[model samples]
Target chain A: MSTHFAADTTVLLGRSMRHVTRSLDTIITTAVMPIAFLLLFVYVFGGAISAGPGRYVDYLLPGILLITVATGVSYTAFRLFLDLQSGIFERFQSMPIARSSVLWAHVLTSVLANAISLVLVLLAALLMGFRSGAGVLAWLAVGGILLVFTLALTWMAVVPGLTAKSVDGASAFSYPLVFLPFVSSAFVPTASMLGPVRAFAEHQPVTSIVDTIRRLFAEQPVGGDIWVALAWCVGALVVAYLLAMATYRRKAA
Target chain B: MTTKPPPAAIHVEGLQKSFQALHVLRGVDLDVPPGSIVALLGSNGAGKTTVIRILSTLLAADGGTATVAGYDVATQPADVRRSISLTGQFAAVDEVLTGRENLVLVARLRHVGSPGTVADDLLRRFSLTEAGGRRVSTWSGGMRRRLDLAMSLIGDPPVVFLDEPTTGLDPQARVEVWAAVQQLASAGTTVLLTTQHLEEAEHLADRIAILHEGRILVDGTLAELKALLPPAQVEYVEKQPTLEDVFLALTQEHA
Candidate 1:
């Protein structure tokens, strides 16, 4: 089984990658929401709110990327739900291939799809004067962090994909994830919020993750926020993976 | 890596399954001999799909022992899976993939060598060569079903389970699937198919087992099943062509 894992996953990955390539509109739709938010925040709201030092697009780019992944992973759930609904999932399960390859293919597709959408968001940001002077190492770190976050959220998306009874319910879980960035340091510094909101904003995982990415782009010392962000991402990944696998076992049985 | 072959191609005894308060399969028994076609006949909720699912290793049975191609479904599922192919009720072809690509995907998954060659062969065998390049979503229901059947035959597994392969197809498509099933049997693949259509059962099955309320009500060959009924009268009656015959004749002419 272990021997066949890589081969099976690669083949299945090619099968789903075709789905993404043929229907490029799914990618466009995924990026549309995040790009819209980016445009709105930078053009309409950036003037009213002060995000300290650099340009507002620069300060908010990390959050927009996060939103991009949040929105993109819904397609993962949607596709998985389509498979389950269409009986294709059962067809895969009954075959003699490594079962884990089925979910891994979708998870990897999520990474690639989100990567493209994130690049699109970055290009839009660059056009809006959101410049990042950080060198190659910082950019690599940023990529690593976003990759981990995408994995965590994609695994979470699988839960709904397996358990959801309706198409709408499968992708609906991402709505809250897209909204989470707004309450964190992605849009504003946590220091400006009053009492309870400030404490909630500071302690939440999104705040640390956004702060770490913001500092990385500016070539500043990442400090302990990077650790906090990684801890949050890894912790979420472990939990989501376990839950998704459990859901999968139930469905397979 | 070595074991003796089971007595039958498919052997099940006292299979049981339940969902919450509903008892889907309450001790069902079935058997299909090697290189033969056995049709399990049942109406809705008669546990036909559940039986197929368990035999195919997709679902666990509450209680029972079953073997496919000499591999125990519960303990030696990997071996059982390697020896069986399943074509589920719905056409499981990928909508975004072309007919040939769908076949190739299954061939690759099964690790059959020269995937493209295998895909083309199946497409030709299923009469889908002309439409092989178009995505499956644009194909007719019959074409999709044929492609689904082609995918299931990737490695020529000895045992095949088809769950109502012709449930919702038109008369012409039904004949196409029936022909495909005959081809499977002639090629020495043991087939266990479930369907509610008695015409289909009589048309292809070497033996028909009627399942009702989670039990095998009757199991026998078509001749044996007919033997249980009263003898036919000797009165003269003109035979008229069935609507099915008319439909098939008309549709085949259009082709």
Candidate 2:
């Protein structure tokens, strides 16, 4: 049974990957927003913002990567909504395929596609004078962190995908996701903000995550932020995964 | 020792299902013998699709016992799924994939070996070889529906459920689909189909079950169903209005 599920997931994953490949726009769309932000921030506001010594692009790149993940997850919801509205989910359910394979295939595809978008935005950041001194192990750690984060967000997207009344409703949930990083340490440090807003920003999940990535890129010591970031990502993943599967069971029920 | 063949390819006893407070299937029962073409006739929202969904394992039944290919739907869902195929009310083919690719994908999902050959065979059988390479999004509704039905046959399961298969089809496409369904039944594939078109049921089904309000109002051959009502004239013209229009007129006057 596990073999059957693995095979079915592989086939469906290939189908989803093909869809992603054909519409280069999905990847292009995900990368474009963060690339635009990187270009605008580094060229227009880089000199003005006091992000300590080094380059402003370096500080900004980490946050841009987070934003890239936020924007990319919207496509996951959009694609899932389309598949639902198109009645493809019903078709898959009837076949002798594994039930969880359908969801896993989409989740896996989201991870792969978002990874590409992250890479694209990073390349554009390099062009804008962003540099990272993190070695192979640090890079691997960053990849793991981003994968967990993307998986968490993608599963959250699945809930809306299954339950939303309209296509706009499905993708609309991601707007707050994309907007979240700005309030964190993405652009300016939370320490610079006033009382309550600064407190809220310092406590949020994105700040720790962004701060950790920023420090890692600059070869600075990242102490507690890394642990907090992983905890947040894993916590979100667990909650969202449970919620998504519950929604799926209700839908299929 | 050889025993008499089993009751039917599909057997349902006291099958009951509900959604929240609304009971969708109220103790419905059915026994569809092997190789027989059974048509389930009902109005919209009458639980015909719901029944089909349950049989195909897409939805669970609140209460009842249903055995497809001798596998219980609730207890042995995977086995039941392995023995059946379903073509839903809408064409469920992936528009992003080409016609041939869609068939190949389903074949692979069903664990068919050399899926390429199975796909090619189905494409040729459906007379879609010429259009095989083009995306399904470019195909006409009739073509898409045909491809959807063809995909359902990839695994060659014993029983197939077609829920309102001709709902949005043109006359020509409807006839084509009917022919394909007829071919499937003739090849000894037990078929359970739901349709609003009485003429379709009359022409296709060896046995018919009329469901109203989620209960089996009547079940028999077409002649037996017609026997339940008074013999009435069916007006026909060279180019006539739809049966739905006439049905609405007659039933509406009675109401």
User: What are the C-alpha RMSDs, in order, of all predicted structures?
Assistant: 2.7, 5.1
Mind giving the per-residue lDDT tens digits that candidate 1 earns over A85-174? 999998998899999999999999999988998998888888889888899999999999999999999999999999999999999999
TM (B chain), model 1: 0.95
- Docking quality of model 2: it rates as medium
Clash list (residue pairs), candidate 1 = none
Error of 2 at A21 (Å): 0.6
What fraction of correct interface contacts does each candidate retain? Answer: 0.88, 0.82
Query: RMSD (Cα, Å) of candidate 2?
Result: 5.1
Candidate 2: segments with Cα more than 4 A from true spot? B1-6, B229-255
TM-score of chain B of 2: 0.88
What local lDDT score does residue A196 receive in model 2, on the 0 to 100 scale? 91
Candidate 2's DockQ: 0.79
Docking class of 1: high
